[model samples]
Target chain A: MAFGKDHELHQRRFGRNLWVGACLLGFVAIVFGLTVVKVTRDGPIEGFDHTVRPQMTEGAK
Target chain B: MTDTSILPPQSGEAGFGDYFALLKPRVMSLVVFTALVGLLVAPVPVHPMVAFASVLFIAIGAGASGALNMWWDADIDQIMKRTKGRPVPSGRVTPGEALQIGMWLSCFAVVMLLLSANPVAAGLLAFTIFFYAVVYTMWLKRWTPQNIVIGGAAGAFPPMIGWAVATGGVSVESVLMFALIFMWTPPHFWALALFMKSDYADAGVPMLTVTHGRRETRRQILIYTLILVPVALGTGLTSIGGPLYMAVALVLNLAFLKGAVDIWRRKEEEAEADGYAVEKKVFRLSLYYLFLHFGALLAQAVLRVYGIGGW
Candidate 1:
């Protein structure tokens, strides 16, 4: 039961897990950044939030 | 983290890099670069964040299709020298996992693209994935000698999709870019087939070389290169083109045509003696031929901002 060195398989698996975690974090950051830019842009805010927006409604213009 | 000594480690168990290898990163780099150029060269200016996200999604879609290809082509890949070491054929990644990853990423990329860009771009990206994965990899690859000719349309779509991301529709410029790639694909691939020897034949792939004789493949390469000259030069005459693009296209096309001619002229005896050196050189130049043309376009776009580009 004495632990000397980690097995090679475990190290590879660990590295894989770390990279997957990093990818997930990066994806989250991109989504967050996109949300900020999209909401703050010059035009009216349009999202799929279920409720109808006035600008999107027919005959509003 | 598990018990250290009991279970023997499984050989060929996949690592993260193996999964990434399933995506064919080299091909993805070409997709990213061409798509970026397509987006940047458009007349409409895109928001940096939106542009970045769109390109990323496009790349993901491309990677997904590549995974699908690796999954489906595993059998033939195991027979081909260059592809036998790929993730699926090498047994580092399972075919089932590759298919699952491909499908999931394809959906994710298309949905994210629709949200990030426009429906048109998303639709094109979806079609591209389908074309590459289902049409090219599944059907045409095994069934026809002209597989690469038609399958090339799958690769040629990215620039058009990139243009659609900015313009929300098609245009002559985008069509021209697509044509440039479509025409270039045959000659480029034929040159590789010439040098690759019998990989396609051994794999039962009906490449032009395997179906038609090598002389016919050589002749076809020259014909396609001849046709490609007009399309490549014609792009230089469009709005995306300028003096710089014309200059670069002229020089590059001449060199490419010369290489094609050299390939066509060399006899089989001399080629075998020299180890297809002329074909190899032509193949190398073809790589630079496409890149420099795209680079010149980007350069022209940049120069236009400085009042020195565009006629």
Candidate 2:
């Protein structure tokens, strides 16, 4: 199929193998990059501190 | 002349992909990425699901603007080689139908954003649609050589909208993001105009290259690029970026500035001697230049999660 052919043809040709490979590579890169930082770092990153407990109290002032 | 035997009429069938092409998926992807960066970098936290929905609606709104742009610019697009094969110009979609789709999607995306986010984000989304479809496409594009320079603001709004969605208001951070893209637009687009001067000339569009001259366009490209480098790096000095992002910005801006200088120093005759290949390379690099800058922002956001000082 040509580059700008219909969606189905695009899916059949580039979608299955090439698209999946590209996406998988992106995912792996992100995960690997994060893991590298996690291993070398001393503590949780500032912006991504998901472990910080949220205050449950309502505004009492 | 005698009447012939009855024959079957041809079907005017259009598919979903054709409709999708009208949305300008490449542009939408940039909108989505930049908007997501805005959301991620905001001081206030939003639920993950809500953030996802907000970005989705923003992407849809960008698509709506693209569709409307195609509908309005179909005449010029049909003549310009760069845009001649767009869905509307190629007869895959009718202008009326494209207009309907664009307007309907514009409303749908705005309402969805309003429901999921706040009114400020919704208002910005609406203004962006109106700016692109009416102000830029309808008024400025045909009138002036500086159309893309001023009109590029419409494309620069998504990150601000995303920041508004996360924080419920505007901030300097969002404005910096807006300014980065807004300043980058002229040099990035003018580089292409330098090489494709003939295309604009053929289509009778008054691009800077066609109206002023290639030398003037090259000078403008260098000036804007010089301005853009500082703005791009300034975003790194803000709360949304950190050391890593700053390093990337410095390197990228230096390279971009070098490219602009090379372009400025060359004459059109010198460039054209090699088929204007240098200008074309700069144009192609400009595309990646934006993507890499934004991609660095996304990387900074992820790094902030692991304590790399993004925030």
Candidate 3:
């Protein structure tokens, strides 16, 4: 019904693949976003530093 | 003669699905998981953004390696029933196109890793791609029976790359991660070759089973399993290895060794009658071995957040 019989057959056969492709594209976009963040940041982008000693990390900084 | 029309359209226009298959996403996933575990377990923590970028590039590099492998193995792939329908062999994508995609992605991944992490990590990622596509695929696979033994280094490099991303240097822990995978590959693969002997034979790939014969292949698997025990167990004493990973490695290795022993004791006639049950079981265990080990490492990383690990 979506694309008539001939096209629909191809569609069903490949339908799940479209979602996988979309997800991969989404993954690429997220990586690109993270890369931009890392490039622009003065320090590490997320800025949640882990270098502070364990005792110091326990409290709000 | 095979009917040209019934064959799955060798010259057909490539679709998005065909292109995705070039990445070998399942294999890329293992690369990502091991890389993630390596990153998380490092004493020097990575910024989330930096970590994400590093892993993403590593995955891209893995995909590039896969594409190049499919390109080179297209002939043998067509001969093997398991791989006959892959993008290059079934002909949804042309060999030339796969080569171009692989080359471009390899450069992009290495450069991106350099920008996001350090040159050490970038260098490792580049070496991994070179090892897999050039050393392993182009040369060793066809040339030797010890293909997986030597070529396994390509798969083993991801964690080292991940560790370098966090600390900008390799350490004992990272090396242990690398060794674990490197040691595991042969037995993992040979077990599959045990049951699917005909496939390797027809493809002329010179797998250990093809070159050394089954009895020798079985003995080699046991020998490698013995060597793997000390390597797998020793990782528990390192920075990333904690109580959980130690326990998990202990249990999995014992189970694996037991399985290898079971396979070693069986003959071809008995195996064939039971549908190669023992070899099939060992093959299934081998698939989970790396995942469970890496999963325990990740679990230890989480436990560290609650103030427990690495002791």
Candidate 4:
């Protein structure tokens, strides 16, 4: 019961702070996740721009 | 009480959490955000693994600075209500232990970054650690009301270091990012000082609110906010940002300026009578102000790849 009383007091004073902190952390995690997605999806674009091929001669055909 | 009794009893029972608290996670978060923005906006591409390593090492360096700051400020921190429960002051960690941890991490982070990235980033990281721990914490904090103004440079270096990691050098774009955070620090911190003046006074910290009084602190907050708007917008004008960033910057700066003006126009008596509502609002808005500005910069980077703006 004593522990409960202390916990309740802490919840009263810092509940909002804790909630906001969690929300901010969650938001950051989501943003980082999205960044990973974007990076992976666009990874080939740079390589595509730089890729080169050699042409075969008609004698080889 | 004699001087001997005034000292905390020496104990060597620090836990993991106590050591983590020494890192100042909140400050680390801001460093990580700005550094990530710098990495994203750099002209040269960095490998994903290398980018991750660079940011991690940068975060560790920021943590090292925080630990050193806590070690140096422990005396004042013990007297301040807001800081009384911190690991050092609460006796969870010894000042000597904190100093050792900070110095060790500072070396480790800088060396690891140098091996992973380049010497430019490592050197900047070393300077940032020294600036925050020595210049800001040891010197400026106890001496002047303009402490936060000059001390803010340490916090402003992350983005530049990040840019260096990617490009292996500094550029105008990174400097703009640095300016944005530097100019924003005063208003952001002074708004908090407006509400927490008594804490600084009790600790003999000589924050602006304690030295110049609340009215002047509020006015300075407004002045800094005015300066911050143009700097935030200027980031958009750089090669790193685009039209999307410009639009976001315009709207955010307008709202921020309005909030600053509201804080400025209110009389002290009115603010006190209203439970310091205006100061609290400004403080909360300042958090979102930085986040939104940086978030828009990241958005502009993404849009540029799609050919929306940065062509």
Tens digits of per-residue lDDT, candidate 1, B1-311, equal 11213222335568999999888899989999999999999999889999999999999999999999988888778777888788777777777788999999999999999999999999999999999999999888889999999999999999998899999999999999999999999999999988786677777788788678889999999999999999999999999999999999999999999999988888888899999999999999999999999999999999988888898
Pitting candidate 1 against candidate 4, the one with the higher TM-score is 1
Candidate order by decreasing TM-score: 1, 3, 4, 2
The runs of at least 3 residues in candidate 1 whose Cα sits more than 4 Å from the true structure, single-residue gaps closed, are: A1-5, A43-61, B1-12
Please provide, for model 4 over B133-214, each residue's C-alpha lDDT reduced to its tens digit, 9 standing for 90 to 100.
9888888888899999988899999999999999999888888888888988898888877776467767777888777877
Once model 3 is optimally superposed onto the true structure by TM-score, how far is the C-alpha of residue A61 displaced, in angstroms? 19
Docking class of 3: incorrect
Candidate 3's residue-wise lDDT over B161-276, tens digit each? Answer: 99999999999999999999999999998898888746876877787776778889999999999999999999988878888999999999999999999888888789889999
Worst 10 residues of 4 chain B by lDDT: B1-10
Q: What DockQ do you compute for every candidate structure?
A: 0.58, 0.04, 0.17, 0.04
Native interface contact recovery, model 4: 0.00
**Which candidate has the highest lDDT of all?**
1
Relative to the unseen true structure, what is the Cα RMSD of model 2?
10.6
- Deviation (Å) of A60 in candidate 1: 20
Q: Where does model 2 exceed 4 Å of error? A: A1-61, B1-11
- What interface RMSD does candidate 1 have? 1.1
lDDT of 4 at B305: 76
Itemize residue pairs with steric clashes in candidate 3: none
Per residue, candidate 2 scores C-alpha lDDT tens digits across B184-209 of 89998888877664576665567898
Residue B270 of model 2: what lDDT? 94
Error of 1 at B71 (Å): 0.8
